[model samples]
Target chain A: MTVHTQHINMTRTPLPILPISLGVLFLGTAITMPFWGQAYWLHEFVNISCFFIFAMMWNLLAGYGGMVSVGQQAFFGLGGYFVLAMGNLAGVSPFIGIPLAAILTAIMALPLSKLAFRLNGGYFAIGTWVIAEVVRLTVANISIVGGGSGTSLTAFRGVDRVFRQHMTYWIALTCVVATVALILLFLRSKQGLALQAIRDSEVAASSQGVDVIRMKLAVYVVAALGCGLAGALYFASNLRISPDAAFSVNWTAFAIFIVMIGGVGRIEGPIIGTFVFWLINHYLSDYGTWYLIGLGGLAIVMSLYMKDGLAGFIHRKTGKDFLSIKRIYRSK
Target chain B: MLLTVENAHKSYGALAVTKGMSFSVEEGETLGILGPNGAGKTTLFNLISGDVSLDSGIVHFNGQNITTLAPFQRCQSGIGRSYQVPHPFGNMTVFENLITAACFGGQMSEPEAYDVAEEVMNSMGLTSLANQQAGSMTLLNRKRLELARALATRPKLLLLDEIAGGLTEPEAQELVTELKKIKAKGTTMIWIEHVVHALLSIADRLMVVNFGEKLADGEPMSVMNDPEVKRVYMGIEA
Candidate 1:
């Protein structure tokens, strides 16, 4: 729910300086990947992008819009399955299937919102989870997409190996960039401000003329589109799909953890949180249960102390927009 | 005349809060609605703001019946209100709070909204706190932020519910002074307050309500002295 409105008292600084540095780093990623890094760096890039996408989606639902969903992974799984089914059975190109998943998921989100909107606060969170489980279980029962066991895209692996790998890498990278960009843009729009106000207090927001129901539904659908597109791109890389992995709660888990750690409301929060999370996971994945225990411990501490998450904590401590929303915040 | 509410009725299970209530306000006039505790002052505000549906009534603004419109649509149509409990976007700056209202309430473009939010905040004495996090503001400032947010929408009819309830005398006076300025600007107001003196200063006409019914409606001085109004307030305050 980020909208870039112009204020009279304070003129927003031109091109937030924080994103300038981040932009430079983005250019560095594209420029330096092949020569400076090995197979491990590429793998890490994919992982980071995946986490980034999750954090962005979660932040959109919870922080600004006040939708605390614990089941966005439903779209992730749906996206993967949609691409797998299209590429294999319908003979559609996997690349074409990614955007197709995005479109279809957004449309499906309309009806899904009807059910999801019936609940409020914590109940809504669990209701979304229930919906995700239902989708997972239904997909598991279908044998067409390999049922519970899952299958590889080895059938289409013959199309092009090196190019497909690069395409997958590009798709993941694009998800990270585009999701952040779209969310920031949406926040500055009329609907975005309304959502934030509603998140603060639905009663007051509605009284002031913010259409809470319509705005909530719009974000719900758009978030689904983002997740669905990301999921499709994820499977497109692996040339494989399965019910458990595609529908895996890991997307939800990863997103929640990152957003909680990074920050909730601010635009740059998810990106910073994703990077920090990936760094921690890289160093600690070798530790097994203790790594999970450590993550749990971090969540507890952050929840108790850093209500705004890591970026919020940093902003408090430093008194600066370390990762400011581009084209906003700095206008003076 | 700008806005009117006729025969508005609302109930909570066995208790009817607003029973067949009716009132109207003219442009540039402040109408004080006085009621004892649980007398349905806030409930009426909620009805006009579109937070609660009427059991039976007609709410007309600028000649159109808006009883069926959503709260947000009401906002777009120039009906804005501040809550008894100031609910600011906790994480946003004070400026950000008003700017949001300008964007959604007035359907303003980016630059226009920025200007409107700034002007509103400045007039509300929120200039220094423009960059401060809303959650960190004091109670008086929180109330100001709420008022600023509502004002940012360029409301034709503004509703204020207990805005000065928790303030000290000087603070309440400051708020009253602001209300007087706003009233002078030609925006109609329906204010519900526990503070009698605050309402006595700005409200041209006063209506007293108790047990979901009107006891008096006329000049503030006369209504404030009404034996029935005195009995209700004294009885409830006791």
Candidate 2:
């Protein structure tokens, strides 16, 4: 009998050794950001962090799980309101409120999964959009959080402005790092493998013993938490949460932009997409609607030609399995 | 015994696909199901495997009733299967495909899953193609990947549905030889095939099913010589 040899390939990119050894590059930037960066850059970082986290969550659902969602902003708005209700009214720390918002989002997603899982492919995408719209309306009816107009976290304004700004920056950074790490860990786990399989083919994956519905539900909840966290962070920075702004569908649109440009189903895709999007917006900060037109056009081109996204393009050129979720196979 | 199907019947509204078909297999026995195209052969496999609901039937596997279980649950109970049409994970590599099944089906730990995947890849003669994306596989290799994925699941009863349908004669023969080798290793098998000769080469017994009914069954040659079986298959009794 021939026994197949299996090995654990646990080598990383040598832990970013060379660049870190060269000097403390991040240390300088981290130190300078709080002291010298303009209010505009501070505001930019807040939205960028949200974009990165939202994009990462979208990538998790559509890229890896192959569940394209146009309604993720539903959670984003729900999360912002959650933070406002918890942090300002309940007097909890905004940081603590963010996690609470995540928990709430995950809990909310449980029931929705039962309904959303019924729709397949494009229908599923549109179904989530409908659900998000329903949530937006339900929240708008409750007069507690300013109803349609929304409320502000003026309680935080009572504290020093500098203290608020610095804390918000760190909180946004934490969200970005934590979300990326958690998704990367999931991609390396059994559930992650199952998600990838379901993405390829539900029937084939089920035959292979993957619980397709359970896996999809798990991703749905995890992604909801990520969007919730981003929403909390977004609201915390501006002391204000409006239903229209917080629940805006454009959040999902922006996330799609980042993931599409960077690469779907790839870890580096969001990062690259976020940076590129920020750079483009940075340059065209004045060209209002034309900017939207150009972005929509870019996404069309990427979808047609760059099936793998930016990370995919790089992988093709480098011949590396950089973004693949392959097992740590053994040696002979 | 690895699996048992008793009085399994399936009806699509008024049309019945599987009508009270029953069978059982001990560990490592290769059971081949041969029938004409509309003979409910694939439906029968689907019923036993939990892919389709049985209108009136009971399926017990490893001494447990799995009639109401989900397909994934049946897989967890050591019942892995391959589709008639090869359905490999198109976006994943052949090795990744096996590993996915091995983790959930075989219930292997991380390192063990990797080891089992590598072993199954080599056993299925897919070592070099391990890194190849499954979507781009040639038909022959796609069939091999499907088999490897099922094997990686470490199922006690492996149900194959027309897996040898589109292969060349040599390829089908090689698959039969592979089946023999697998049978020797003590895994129970239920193979459905239209390649009568290839099936006869390895099947311990043969049964002919027609129009969701068992037309003839017994020893291979006797079943083959049955006038009714001939009438249904080629319209002539030799």
Top DockQ prediction, candidate number = 2
Expressed as tens digits, the lDDT of each residue in B108-202 for candidate 1 is 87677777876787688887777788989899999999999999989999999899998999999999999999998889999999898898889
What are the TM-scores, per candidate, against the unseen true structure?
Answer: 0.93, 0.93
Best by lDDT: 2
| Regions more than 4 Å wrong, model 1 | A1-9, A31-36, A189-191, A326-332, B236-238
Residue A149 CA displacement from its true place in model 2, Å: 1.5
Model 2 chain B weakest 10-residue run by lDDT: B23-32
Deviation of model 1 at A20, angstroms: 2.2
The regions of model 2 sitting more than 4 angstroms off are: A1-28, A321-324, A328-331
* lDDT of candidate 1 at residue A295, scale 0 to 100: 91
Give a tens-digit lDDT track for model 2, residues A1-332: 12232343422122334434432565467546868888677777987898899999999999878899999999999888998888767888786788898889889988888888889889999999998898999898888888888888855756788778887887786677678668877886668789888888888888888888788888889999999989888888878888889878999999999999998888779988999999988898578899999899999999999978887888889765444456433335
Q: How much is A275 displaced in model 2, in angstroms?
A: 1.6
